[model samples]
Target: MQKIPYTTINGGSVPMMILSVFSMITFTSVYGFDSVWTEWWWTYDGFSGPAWWGTKWPICTMGRYQSPIDILPDKLLFDPNLTGVVFSSEKKINGNLTNTGNDITLFVDDVIVPLINATSGPLQYVYHLHHIKLHFGHDEASGSEHTVNGQAFPAEIQLYMFNADLYANYTQAMSSPNGLVAVSIFLEVGKIGNEAYTMISNALTHIPTKGQQHRVHGLPLSVLLPQTKEYITYEGSLTQPQCQETVTWVIFNKPIYITEQQLTQLRNVNKEGGSHLLIFGNIRPSQPMYNRLVRTNINFRPKTKVCSMVKEVFYEVNTVQTRSGR
Candidate 1:
């Protein structure tokens, strides 16, 4: 059953997060990829989908550490060592967006003014953002791979990053220990949209089919992130094939917002040569946590009474500023 929206964890069986519901237009067809560059041509389903991925790469099925684990806020350990991660980059970044057949990724390797790097949280070495991957489902209830208390978000934004401090490139870092970080942000639909998300949403009109490319200039990477800084961290692997167990995952507690119309734009992208949408449900299913240590910096204390008292003293208007981080 779907839970109440905006439910926070104080204690007990209540969910950590449940996004506000809205009606979403449906796309029933499944598309293919034209620019899929993988040697094996692995997909999410059918002939050679996720089920067959382990046959080609043993680590996928054998590895103890895998990514996109469901996060339980109540069970998350409060680690004092976990702190706010700082993101540094040029005022704006330039990149070409591609429908990789897998997901829509923003490749910013070439046009970086200086560099886009994240440091000082769960990361021991600096990691560089190589690309941005967007994952979504056919509808609003189930897109994000990582779930909060078993509830999914509409979509997810992943910073496919590599440890630049220890490795030269993502290819080299993919297999090495402590080589990559999965910086994930949850995406939900709201009334007013985020400017950066709106820009990308509008640009989607140019690339409706697979293997299509569009250039996006002056993208502020910082604007895509949440300012709250509180997050959950764990050691895990890549979500796809050859699932290397060399990743440090930092999932923020706060979610970013995009307009319902903007999300529909993302839902409209196709894979390769079909009327169906590649983005209809491109997200990987959440893997088991096993005995993994899930840590967070967020204070899980009850806030119902505090919010009640504060609401009387200060009545703030419903504006974008209320959600400053997103």
Candidate 2:
């Protein structure tokens, strides 16, 4: 097996390492810009595909555990034995934000880095937070990569982690079947903006053009995740070209809210090669689930409990009003 070379550096100084992990990487140039034209080549037109994958990128079309599947609620298996995720406590970590023309990525490095680790929850190994990537669409209506029971969201955020017990570096880990784990969070349009996303969003101004990057300080991983750990787990492949069937996916049940303006900013970011052309819909369409069983820890109780709670609240409020004689 060929080993991928990787290193850690502070202040956004490390050079981009090109590897066979993702085929679109071959399009990166010496100046750190990736061509928008090259990124568009691999994207599938819709939910199903014997994609542009077979002829050139065969693994994607042939891979059994392909990702971005439409998760059917009725099809999920309720697994009581699945352990809940225990993540490292929230803290600030130094990182860099960069635009690859297709998506925005943030890398967590070791400059005053806090120890970040997560265990259990369908994982056979402990994993550490490696980095983050954001996926969105050209329009507000349909940008998310993964859909819930055929419903698509405005965007999605993926937190990539490496099995610390197995491989020493993240890049080296992607080649193996159990090497990588990604926690996916869906993003919806709402009135309030998420403060956790501000660190990366603020940095976008400095790196508005493709291939350009800016170093970020004090990004807290704690703020980037959902308040609850309710998620659906399944085995799947990377959504990008040279799609490897190595990821253990954990898609959170609830979505974090962001404003419409913020969504627009993400859609309008420039592609690599420094063109004004905005890259829209940077997501792979849903693949076939085949026979994979998606397991979840959430046990949706019967409607009886919901009604009881509402009735109790109403009774308590009515009693208070009667006591006041109003």
Candidate 3:
């Protein structure tokens, strides 16, 4: 039998040094180099294999009792007490368009909604509108929400609001449903085009791909709201990741329209530093029915009071202390 010679380095075994170096390289490749760990390992199920983890943790498993759900008009019941009053200060705002290859940014304003009111129940919660974001796609049919007749709209705008008192940080609110409310608006391609697009588009030249800071003046949210005020309401969650089921969705029946050229400019926006910001479709797919009810509301008229018959589920998470002691 032949014997292999042992090597030493700095009063230690050389083999151990080689092994340590190999371990470090493996660790760096798996974690330090990229975000693969966050995408796979840090999820609900620990990383094992594609099949094992995928089965254990499907898409909706991470959701709480409530989540972001799509509401169909026919299924909703009208309610006068649960009405939401729409108000805007007519203040112009601006932000940088950080188009980082995937999502495009437009009018990321610092909005503050000091007040919100809801009906009494588990869903009775007040929140604030923190900021608003706009996303446009290549074609009119590539929006987030599709019509019941299976027709896609032109663009989608997400008004991201949060419980200003509950979670001081946006990231915390995103991970859990209790602190966020996203009002989504679908835009259609019309012959007249949308006037709201003009307010942001005329300033597009000032905002470059890498993110040029642009200002908007007198761009009130009322311009984007549906005139009819007839909306489909449901108890859902945020559409983004860590999909918490804590949002009260109010989807308007009518849609706003924008021209093809305005849509092109919005799609061309890039994130800061010349990143390849590809503003593809940013809307999440419609979620399950989940034994939830959809409600609707019309103008205030002399009619009998009708209550929403939606099924409600109790979430046992400890309530956080708020300034209002809610």
Candidate 4:
């Protein structure tokens, strides 16, 4: 049976005490969110026909603002009104790292620990931290969900939040139009590794099989984000099934670095039930922009000053060489 929240007035069951302790100490699947595993294009079942999804899950084919769209640098509009996003979480938040069938998720225990809160970007309401998930591939070439100028990064990370002002729970928020916010950061392979991600990557060896969860403590949410706050904002749906169009996407312009060893650790997680099938490469193909305006917080000038100056010097030298030849 699903565990219920504890109350001080009614008490005394052994199971209740255990449940309360576990809930306060860790984050379990409170929402019970599920995605279709068999219907994906990359899966062994391999039934990727959009027609089938239209029949089974209409939202997959019908959503107007679908996620994982390529962000064309030339196409983005500069929104002077867009403000910088504010993100604050506890310095030492404890969590349980779970190898969910689809991806690896770090579930924060917010009841005992302070939950992360974000506000004031392109958002009208305050958003409370929900969870974080990782998406990666076999190599450093192509793993990210959203691409910039059709270029894919090695991996990507998504930090999710639910609108606290509008809804009391996650299910209700998923049903609303503006109920979720996702902060996406791209990951690149580098010489040095990220210490924040080491907490999760180190635990992947223990939870190789699906449905396996391990406890992790004192994880700082601040270290997981990119150093820069500059980002591109757009309206998009969840990349997974049920394809809810409730997310306001804030994809960071800057990417964080992870080492080759760290990437290998992420690629080692297996499919559920001891199948031993590594859950590597879970990026959904980019969706069409379809007349939607991708907005950025800052204005982008097309050319660099240094490049323009170099071009002028090169032109002058070329003319001199040509005149001498004549």
Residue-pair clashes per prediction, in order, are 3, 0, 14, 0
The best candidate by TM-score is 1
lDDT of 4 by residue, 176-214 (tens): 979999899888777987778778788887788878889
lDDT measured at residue 256 in model 2 versus the true structure, 0 to 100: 79
Q: Which residue pairs show backbone clashes in model 2? A: none
**Better-scoring candidate (lDDT), 3 or 4:** 4
TM per prediction: 0.79, 0.77, 0.62, 0.77
lDDT for 12 in candidate 2 is 43
TM-score of 1: 0.79
Tell me the TM-score of model 2.
Answer: 0.77
Could you report the Cα RMSD, in angstroms, for every candidate shown? 16.4, 13.5, 11.0, 13.1
Local accuracy by lDDT, each model:
0.73, 0.72, 0.52, 0.71
1-326, model 2: which lDDT tens digit per residue? 97656544564433336333233454444323334333545444443333666555667877778888987555667677777788884667677788876678887885432378778889989888888889888776578888765667888999888887888777788888598888998887779877878777788888777778888887767777778867788899878766878899998867778888888888878875656777667888788877777777666552221211111211111111111100
The runs of at least 3 residues in candidate 3 whose Cα sits more than 4 Å from the true structure, single-residue gaps closed, are 1-70, 106-126, 175-177, 203-218, 267-277, 298-326
Q: Which regions of candidate 2 fall more than 4 Å away from where they truly are?
A: 1-50, 110-114, 302-326
